[model samples]
Target: MYGVQINDDGTIEQMNDELAQACVNGLKNLEIHNYPQPINMEVSLLSIFCGFYGTSNETISAEGIGNIRKFNKLSANADKNYGQASSNGERKPNPWILTKILRYHNKDHYEQIIKPLLKKNYEGKKKEKQIQINQTLILNKIDLTDDFTQLDMQEKAANGEYEKEEQIVMDLTRILIYYEGETEDIYAIKGYDAICDTQVLYHKLEGTVYKQLEKININFKNKKIDEKDNSKPITVKHIFKKYASKFFKKRCKFISEDPKILTVFQGYKYKKLHTIDYECLQMYFYLIKETIAAGDERVYEYILNWIAWLIQNPGKNRELQQYYKVDKVQVKIDSLM
Candidate 1:
């Protein structure tokens, strides 16, 4: 009855229709203002065009492709984050990281934090060259011995890759200052970052615990007491299995009280969602961590089982949950996915 109310009748036609509507609505409500520049709009539109006209087919307009190239050049020239083309005529910027920074962070934030960081990175190349020049001068003056070679390596290792600590502090302080702008300002942004960091740490720890649980080889099926040698320390897997089973058993009692959860299993088989939209997963993980510390392996099992169960049920509006509206990460889940 709940499923019908939600129009999730397990019909392929309904699913396809809903998807089509979503796509149309997405295109109709498209906003280019959020991008670093209008050139990014051309890049995005080009991508969409290419996707519509498959790679094998050259049905896409050449003008659209040219626009992509034009914008890319303009974008690079406009943003100092991307360095000038090298002698080899290749773009030397870490495009992946740069794009991610541009996409998620605001223009003001980017100018304050990312711009300086990018400048520092670009300066690092100059420092490396300077170090090399210095090394060559020393080598020319000194004898060609193994000791000198060792010294050269040490000098290069010490000074070749240097970070501007002052610049870093300035960038980070910009964020703190921005948050401290409002009257009666509490450092809420740092607290938010701390919470996010905790979630990320817990997520990673939970993933490790799951992998260990899955690869568990020790048997405890019919044992009443400890059978392993006492002299040897308890293995992580052994401890994990012991506590996880305990927590699973404890959690099983809750299902009886709330029988609705049991119905979730009747709908579909468990399968990983083929989408990069995991904002809900992060939220669920945080809830699990809050309920129980992730240091305890049982908590990992609890979260993993919950995720597995959620992925199986089509009745749940999992897609809707996938998008997280946060100040730091305003991701367009549909486009990104």
Candidate 2:
């Protein structure tokens, strides 16, 4: 399972369950439903509270009910990046991306509960916002949060590596970073996908990838993935389908694999992925560059199918086969489905 991490001065920490429970009453008081229900709920709210790179000083999110607010009206750069570092100075750890769980982010949960909880706790506590967040209830948010883990296990009744892997299967672009703390490091904690091409990267895990995990020695509490929320399996595939449908202004009945994309990636090898005619690149860029329209007729269909193929075969390079942690991701994806 993937636990929510709080990087305090470069040291990693997980969300405190006691703190989450402590705020249950506060969230309920605000008429917020499903507070602290999801696995990453705490972190998700906290990340949103950090503000969107100080982009707007607005109090709330549009189109949602709870209206998740910006606790700090005048947010600084410090307010952004959550606990992530400032720049790429040296090699540091980066977390893997997970399938976003925005199931409960609508009005009642996000706005009423999460937004108010953060604003209420963070007003006078900016000086020790991290402390307030770590110790107090407030909230935790985890937008595109990257991480590293030395996860390996083949036991029953308990699992972590597999949960992280399953997230990558759905998430696709996420990759593992090898860091040796005081010496070696890898940057790009947030938005690692932005730096890479399409996902369809890993269909297998690297054997010594565990060696890299051993190097970083990521030590965080155990947090399992929430397979089913309200009897429905939580999924990001549906989320992607939703956006793709809206983007092309058509119903994405079912996304299928695009053989052309994979045929081009056969035997391709690289540590870092580079864009080469859909050979390797990100779906965001792939779709945006062409900017297909509903009126594009069958072109719209082809674009959606291509995205579906990317989801199935996302790989950065030969390194991705080793980096995507296929074993870890596959187990989780299998269990969830």
Candidate 3:
């Protein structure tokens, strides 16, 4: 019999087309609600059995079917073995691999063997560079500048209204700087550096500023402090301390010249900042700012604690469920035709 495997959602995740055809041929007495129903049922049964029992017959023959039975037993055996291996977790296959294999076998020709023979039958040849230039012009016709400008304006407006906690902003910034310089993506940086950076930056900034103040006091008494010399370490310290609050406020705005820098401090609130790693808290702030800027009420939809909110309020919205339940797979299938 043909073999098939399905996900929990009843979507056909895998199938052995040849084996399915064999099952259809052998089980002709079974009702065909659709021309393909018997084969589909056989495959589903194979998948279910394999998943439950970890194995099934390597070969199958219909009852009272003599040696001249319609379907190929060898095909059924191979399919059954594959299904068994998959169900038992003895073999793992990527989805794409299975798709390509099934496609090739159903066509009754090896794709690799026939691929080179396929050729474009153009009546006339065009210059390759000319073709490339034409493609580039077509792609460049799309105008993204208006969208980008709108996003920027919205971001600036949101930043104008935002009031962020100083400590959270600093913590978020340092983490962004560290991970921004590293190979990790934004999400990875959030996971790894958020909390540690918060603690580290706060201490480092506090200590360095305090130490510089102490050194400046000692130098002033000895008349060694050069007021005009910008090169002096004390001068650097004073510059940092002088603008520290303003610098932090700018960092907290979440609409800096650097998008990455802004992203780091996105969600800094004094009350909630204490609970999460510095990175995630910052991202939360940024996301809030972005959503507000975009005029999207769905900003809270992806909040870290949203799942808890759903559990706390547990009446299902049937309209929302129906909206989600419309068969996206069937839509895709219909689109192909």
Candidate 4:
């Protein structure tokens, strides 16, 4: 006696009995059957089972068995292609397979996989269709307006909701560079202004416009005094006090605001300036571009300073900085200015 379960697609789901016995040497000797959980047996019976249950009078034959063997071979090849096969040519459990199994074994898991994939596929297809439906939207838009506003471009982009093809990515890069410039204005402005303002505040609090010059002298005196008598110069306390007052004033200003946006902005500025280098500015631009592309608008003041930093540093970091050299920086600044 043999039993099988098959999907509507004629794919094997499970098998049992004489065929299983032949494949695993003897069904009775198999330890899997006595276990609490059901065991899977590989056999050609699933297609046979589907054929038997169907309205057709077709019977399973030698050719049907051969077809099952072909399916198994093709499945093995697919598994191998996905690196889900062991060196011994046995298929190993993988996320893709496990996902399928979980879908079959549990309703929640089934919904989890089906819902997301179905939603994503449907949304992608829907957007593609909408683009065709509104085929002349961009053309009509350009005809109506002499200059394309950000809002207009955004609406087109939303309707054009086509997946970003590689060529489109290049085109987008060119367009973004042509009008908007390579670097982001908000990021450059915020970063540049924050650093400058902080420096200015430090100078004002210190009662000296030449704090850096005074610090250099104090550093020299400390070095010389240490060399002579191993006594550190007392100028250290004066320098520390001057800077500490500025630090406290900044902190007081920061804390004076409502805890949400002000706190976040201060922290963001601090992190941005802590490592104010070419790489940092480049990364900041990347994030800004992504945010804008995603239609998010949360501008911060530090963006200006970020641009200035990019202009100043260009690419002196250990890693490659050719893309952010002085020429590039100057071009970026010119765009924002």
The TM-score measured for candidate 2 stands at 0.17
Stretches of model 2 off by over 4 angstroms after superposition: 1-5, 8-114, 117-160, 163-167, 170-221, 224-233, 236-337
* TM-score computed on alpha carbons, candidate 1: 0.16
Per-prediction TM-score: 0.16, 0.17, 0.17, 0.17
lDDT of 1 by residue, 1-337 (tens): 0011111242211212222222222232222221233433333332233222222223222332333334434343423322222211122211222223243433454455444554454455546654554344311111111122222322432442213222222222221111122233222111112322221101123444445334423332222232233224323244333323112211111123352111112222233457866886788667555434333445456446656666674344344323333334433333311
* lDDT at position 121, candidate 4: 45
Record all residue pairs in model 1 with backbone atoms less than 3 Å apart, i.e. clashing.
none
Report the C-alpha displacement of residue 281, candidate 3, in angstroms.
Answer: 29
Assess each prediction's global lDDT (C-alpha) against the native. Answer: 0.30, 0.29, 0.29, 0.29
Q: Candidate 3, 331: how far from true, in Å?
A: 70
Count of residue pairs whose backbone atoms collide, per candidate: 0, 35, 9, 20
RMSD per model, one decimal: 33.4, 27.5, 30.9, 28.9
* Model 3 alpha-carbon miss at residue 322, Å: 61
| CA lDDT, candidate 4, residue 65 | 29
Give model 3's TM-score versus the native structure. Answer: 0.17
Query: 1-337, model 4: which lDDT tens digit per residue?
Result: 0121233365643322222222222111111111112212321122222222221212322333233334333333333332222222122211122223223333363464443543454455546754553443221101111233323323434444423222122222211211121342110011123443321111122233223223322223112222335435323224333222111211212223432111112222233346557875786676654432222222222444455565565432323222223322222223332
lDDT tens digits, residue span 1-337, model 3: 0112333365534323343233223332221121112232332223222222221222332121221123323244444464343344323322222222323333333243222122111111213433443344211111211122212322433344222222222322232222222332111112213443322122123444345333321122212122224324332234334334323322322234453242323322233345657775787566543442232334333332344444454442222111111222111111111
Error of 4 at 211 (Å): 36
lDDT of 4 at 178: 10
State in Å the error of residue 148, model 4: 5.4
